[model samples]
Target chain A: MRGCADVRALLGDEAVYEAAAAEAFPEYNKAHLVSLELPDRSGDIIITTYGELDKNNYLDPRTAQVATVNHIKQNCTELRPAADEELPSAYIEEFRSALDVELSKYVGEAYPKGVCAVYCTSGKDIEGPGANFGFAAVISAARRSPQNFCNGSWRSIWTLEFSDESQFVEIKGKIQVGAHYFEEGNVQLDTNIDYKYSTILQSAEDCAVSVTNIIRHHESEYLSSLEESYLNLSDATFKDLRRKLPVTRTLFAWHNTLALSLTRDLAKELAIGK
Target chain B: MEAAMDLVRRMPPGSTETALNALLSLLPDHSIDLLSQVDLPLQVCMDKESLKEYILCEYNRDADSYRSPWSNKYEPPLEDGTVPSEDMRNLEIEANEVFSVYRDQYYEGGISSVYIWEDEDKGFIACFLIKKDGQGKRGYMQIGSWDAIHVIQVGPEEEGAAHYCLNSTVMLSLTTDNKQSGTFNLSGSIRRQMSMTLAVADGHLVNMGKMIEEMEGKLRNSLDQVYFGKTKEMVCTLRPPPEVLNMRLPDR
Candidate 1:
């Protein structure tokens, strides 16, 4: 291999200083760093770099220099084989049992409003370092509409894609969360709860009188936005907002009930327990 | 005119198959009641081209309010809209002319496949023809097929409701026709067929055989009252020559 000093002298400083592919191999070129014994490393740090021009084109050399210094500072001190081997059956069982042990703690919690459970299946098809640890979790909460404690049910579900990666193991995965307050056959108030359907008897006729006034406060901006298609966001966000509308109405009803209950309790307290 | 162009542009490009289907089922089911209300002595006539225009016009008029099960978007109401766009206005005129031409051609050259018989004593008499005309010629392969069927029915009187049984079978096929002349010229065709039996009594589906049995006696009684005692000469309207009449009848 030619000496760095000799090559640099041959090519002027400007050409030699080009950190990218040096304009010679513009189409394809790659570089890798294998650190045997750097300033603060007991082991080795190896990184394969492909493509020209570092993705982050921060013009400030100071920031780039700082990152380089930090990387050098964090380089591994001890040499170790990459622990990316296929996870064995025993280890998989151990991981699942551990999750079960953690979930069992919430067994006695109140869940009449709603309950969520998630399951994971692993076999020969998907088996690798990142794929070895794969599982999901779902949580559901149900709150009764405060109007009569039974006027409606507000349910929400949160699903999480969880991956276990302890130590330095490259993990690639996704986590998704969804919340739904209504299911089939449930009381479906008009998109705007103002116009009630003749087919369905209102669970609480009084509930509507109160909710109608509350929804009026929100109808102007929300309804007009719904009438037009120029919403600032994506179709998905629009659908999500539509789903949340009823949930908001139910929550408001619950809030009213809670406030009324608090006022009644306070009056009793003021009466000296009479 | 501008509004009409916008509407047209908004519609997804449709294939010839879809256009043919729309032409076939052009009449909306809800219009049947309105058609029945037309006076008994009324004589309705339509040509293929005219029928197509009438169907399209009806569709455009009702599209805004009707919530079609096949469409996802709810079309906005256009009650107060005016003919503001010159393009759309021109298109409107052109469409009218096109429809009129088609209608005229159909009236002039199209076959009169319609039949209607009315009796004041009965509630209603309705007859219509459903036909598919197809013909195409290629150098190596030629194809020609025409399928036609006519249905005639009498409705129940207002005073009395009776059960009606209808048993029918249809064979449906989805076929494609392809033609290639040289290295570059190529085309394809499509066909769909469906057949079913439907029985209705008092506006609801019922067992076909049972309803048929119940109506058989009532029909025989009516025939006896109308034609049982009539002489053959009085009842028969057409008479073939003696030679043709003397021919032997085929075995049942």
Candidate 2:
């Protein structure tokens, strides 16, 4: 059985990506690298501190400022890791860059206190590192002050290991708020407050199994069709993946995107403002 | 023997009644009057209505007097209170028309096949092979007597083609015996929906009218083979080749 190629390889040539990034951001090469074990400790991710080693810039600013305040609010916490699984070492930079792009869009005036960056290195068996923009934590920290953390985004990363040749990793993040924080400048606090995420998943597993489970409803044709869209991973596109492996997408959305979105709303419900 | 040969010569060829009459005429003059009904048709027993009547007579003869009222006595009410007379009349008229039309079509080359078996005891069986236009669409239709345990089955020659069977009067089956193996027994409506879903998935369901027309053509072709083969077998069984009939006739 021919196993699938690495997900990075499937995406495109790595040299082109590195060259493009170097041309786009000169600061990208000059950044100082620091590895931190994630809070839940699934693995570690390497953080590139764009040209500086200042640790203060990465911690939530609201938490740093709240030390001066007399009244301290409860710190909003994150959901614990469901399982201690590590991501692959070779794919860490890709994961970090993807998260960086997603989180950069959320660090606007909408989140009054601004966003923070954090990194986690791969585990004992894992070689890659992952990064997250602590947008949800920023909101929680912001809630400690008299500021309303209304609109922003947060990220989540999930890694799954199949006993076979390829490893499946999904990187997704929440982008938009569902409820109106304040109506006509009056706070209309409703229990229906929710957060929704735009999801993206990258999986490198046996193409046959992935594609079959994608269309699990049509179980009858899975085996014969295993080689067609599935093993043809040499140049499989997102559209092809979406069409062929719909179940994988649903699973990725459920595990990474929906789970993260729920965690954000759960944090708000538990301790963010109240 | 001489009188029996004369009676056989006088009777019309291919008339089961005449054949039975000739056979009975072979009996001694004293014993000829013993049989109350001596002119029954040779193939009359195979007719659907005759079969039903024979079954009813046998059942009633052996039936216990205390048998439950709900037991199938093979006696259905001619006029039931639940069914209006007008509706019943309409149904009977429609049924007669359908049978007549199909019978006419079935006899006139509607089906096509070779008769492999023609035995009065074992009954008629037709062996037919149909190769559809597409490459993977070859199959065989094995049709036996209507009352046979395994009456009819349409199956792919190898695999990958659609398969269906009518095992009994009440049982209709669709089989997925391609790379995968699964079978579904569905009613008329459910089967229609399933085939429609398959057609839609294949992008041929854009025009239902055309799809239905194509289906009708396919069905007619298949039925033509099945019925035509079956009819040939039955014809051979009821009226043996003239040479064999002549060999069986008493010498002048």
Tens digit of per-residue lDDT, candidate 1, span B132-231? 2122121211222121122223344344443232321111111112221111101111111222233333221122212322232232222222221121
Reference A-B contact fraction recovered by candidate 1: 0.00
RMSD for each of the candidates: 34.3, 36.6
Candidate 1, residues A1-274, lDDT tens digits: the string is: 1223333333335454354224422221112122222223322222212101232110111011111212222232332221223222444434434433343223112222323222233331343434433333222222333232112221111112223343221212111111111111011111112112111112223322322232222222332322221122112221221112222332123213334445655885989777
Best by TM-score: 1
Task: Report residue B108 deviation for candidate 2 (angstroms).
Answer: 70
Give candidate 1's TM-score.
0.17
Q: How well is candidate 2 docked (DockQ)?
A: 0.00
lDDT per residue for candidate 2 within B1-252, as digits (tens), equals 333333332222224245555345435452434232222211111123323211111112222221111122223322222221343233332322232222223222111111122224322221221111111112211111111011222232223232222221111111111222121111010011113222222111112222322333333333233322232222223223345546655852
Off by over 4 Å in 2: A1-94, A109-125, A128-168, A171-187, A191-274, B1-252
**DockQ of all models, two decimals each:** 0.00, 0.00
**Regions more than 4 Å wrong, model 1:** A1-90, A104-110, A123-131, A139-274, B1-252
